[model samples]
Target: MLHLVTGHAGFIGFHTACRLLERGDGVIGLDNLNDYYDPALKQARLAALQALATRTGGFYRDVRANLADAAAVDAVFAQHRIERVINLAAQAGVRYSLQNPRAYVESNISGFVNLLEACRHHGVGHLSYASTSSVYGASTALPYSEHVAADHPLQFYAATKRANELMAHAYSHLYRLPTTGLRFFTVYGPWGRPDMAPFLFTRAILEGRPIQLFNHGRHSRDFTYVGDIVEGVLRASDRPAAPDPAWTSAAPDPARSNAPWRVYNLGASAPVALVDFIDALEAAIGKPAIRELAPLQPGDVPDTAADTTGLQADVGYAPATPLREGVQRFVDWYRGFYKV
Candidate 1:
């Protein structure tokens, strides 16, 4: 199958595309390579993908364009027989959204709608896009389930992701499109984004700088590994959503609908405290971090956990990498990549 992956230069997108290529699937990677983090890192990932294609003898195509450009997105669909699409392109970051709401709207909302339009027009079999755990904002729900109400989002970033789910549902209902929205928790691993906690903490520790511990080290996250996430993504892509026969409007489940729409939480299910994560990182790096406790930032959740039952039941897989092991792998990659 020929799969189209948006944000192919991104951390998750790069890993997903590489895995697809390793499995001998035709892949068309699309990314604007925005400087949300380091475009150099993104470029390196793209180069790795190209090298992998040559090594594995996989069909790989690269498209450099912004998803928000209607003409660009349409041209991609026009040029390729894209059977499935994994939309990971977004202006991601919780706190960054505070300063740049317009960026979120332009990339996450507008860009997503453009892809949906192309998918609907091109008769794409399945469409899987990234949502976020932040959508469960202000809810003290433990191990958030797909059935839980997630109408309240704390940040503009989370709100955009929630809007994608709604927008996807509307498209699915109106056009019978098979759509799957993945609510990703804290994903961390090698080639990860620098904005995330893992990279920030690692860099700070290596540089002998103080690592900021938000919520006074009380915050917890379901830090999933990127490799596990890739497994779930491919499985979800293979299984196109179908209308739920059990769906009823009286007490409708937030996860499934009468339309061919479904949502699943992808996470490790293991919520580790901020302090514990720091300890793991320190162990991996062979050094202790200088900690600076700080109050929680605006729109920051104190804790997040994923129920992942729906994902496991549907795709027969869930994120399983332990925190210590995953952190070690990331640290090794960091040391090698940056020669630290």
Candidate 2:
């Protein structure tokens, strides 16, 4: 399979691309390598991918370009015979959206449309894109299900991602495109984003700095490991979406449609409190954290628990890693990578 993966230098994207390459698939990786967090980390991930491709004898091409550029996207499609598209690119960070709204509109909305247009024109077989558990915003439901209506988004970032689902659905309906939107829960692991809690907490603990606990350590999250997430992505990519035979217009399922479109929540299906997760980190690192409890920030949810039954039923998606084991792996990687 020839796969085109946007944001291929990103945490999940890099891992996903590597997995595909290891299986002897040709991978075209597109990433702008922006300095949103640190471009150096992105570069390092790309270097690792290059090394993996060399070692595995798998064809890999690293394309440095922004997804917002229509010409660039169109050119890539014209150049390569792309069979599938795994779009992991977007202006991520919920708080960042509050500060810079245009970034989300440009990357998440406009850039997404460009990809959709290219996919429609290029005859791509299947398009699997990343969504977020944050899309379940404003819904006080525990164990968020794919079947529930996710109409309300708490933040602009979540709103943009929700918009992506709607946009994908429209394209799928109008052009008969096969699209699958994977609503990933709080993901963490080695090479994780520095902006996330795991990385922040680990770094702070290692440096003897104070780690901020939002919502007074009361909020919980379904923190899925990156490896598990990549597994689900691969499985979903292998299966092109088909119209749900049981779908009906009268009681339209939010996750499925009569068109070739579907949505699935990908997570560990286990919620761990912030303080307990910190405890896991402390155990993994053999050090205690200097905690600074703070009130919940704007656009932050109290908890997120994924009801992954839909994903498991559709793609046999099962998250295999335990939280402690995953955190330990991450801590080990952090120490080794940073020479801490």
Candidate 3:
């Protein structure tokens, strides 16, 4: 199969692309390579993809373009025989969204619409896109379920992600497009986002700096490992969404629709305390972290736990990586990559 992977130079995208290539699929990667964290890291990921492609004899081509550009997206569809699409490109930080809401609007909203248009026009079979656990905003519910209503988004980032789900549903309903949105929970592992907690904590601990514990170490998260995330994504992509036969408009479930659209949580289903996660990192690095407990930042959720039962039932998805092992793998990669 030929796969079109947006944000291919990104953390998850890079891993996903490599997995696809390894499975003997031709992949075309698209990314603007914006300096959201470090352009060097993005470049390194791209280089690694190229090397792997050369070694495996699997075609891997990357196009430098923004998803917001309709012409660019259309051109790619027109040029390649793209069978499936994995849309991972977006302005990705919750705090960053608070600072610049426009970026979220441009990339997450406008860019997603462009991708939908291209998919509808082209003969794309399955369109799998990244949604966020942030969409479960302001809901005090533990073990957030896909059937629950997510109308109250606390941050602009969550709002945009919710908007994407709505937009994809519309496309699926109108065009019979097979679209699946995966609501990813606190994803972390090697090559993780630099802005995320795992990377920040690892860097601070290695450099002998204090690690800030938000909400004074009271927060909890379902930290899904990146490898598990990539595996779930691939499984979901292979299984194109189908309209639920039991779906009824009178009592509609938010997770499934009468159209060929669905949403599932990709998470570990086990929420770990912030301090415990930090301790795992410290153990991985063999160094104790200088603690700096601080007040919770705005647009941040105090806790998140994923109800992945639906994902498991549908795709047999199960996250198998233990937190300690995942943290150790990340620490090893960080040390090797940064020479710390």
lDDT of 3 by residue, 28-98 (tens): 99999998899999999999999999999998899999999999999999999999999999999999988
TM-score result, candidate 3: 0.99
Candidate 1 backbone collisions, by pair: none
- Stretches of candidate 2 exceeding 4 Å from the true structure: none
Each prediction's RMSD over C-alphas, in Å, is 0.7, 0.6, 0.6
- Candidate 3, run of 10 with poorest lDDT: 205-214
How far is 302's C-alpha from truth in model 2 (Å)? 0.3
After TM-score superposition, what is the CA distance of residue 52 in candidate 1 from its true location, in Å? 0.3
TM-score of 1: 0.99
Model 2 misses residue 189 by how many Å? 0.4
Candidate 1 weakest lDDT stretch, 10 residues:
314-323
The residue pairs found clashing in candidate 2 are none
Per-residue alpha-carbon lDDT of candidate 2 for residues 59-148, written as tens digits (9 for 90 to 100): 999999899999999999999999999999999999999999999999999999999999999999999999999999999899999899
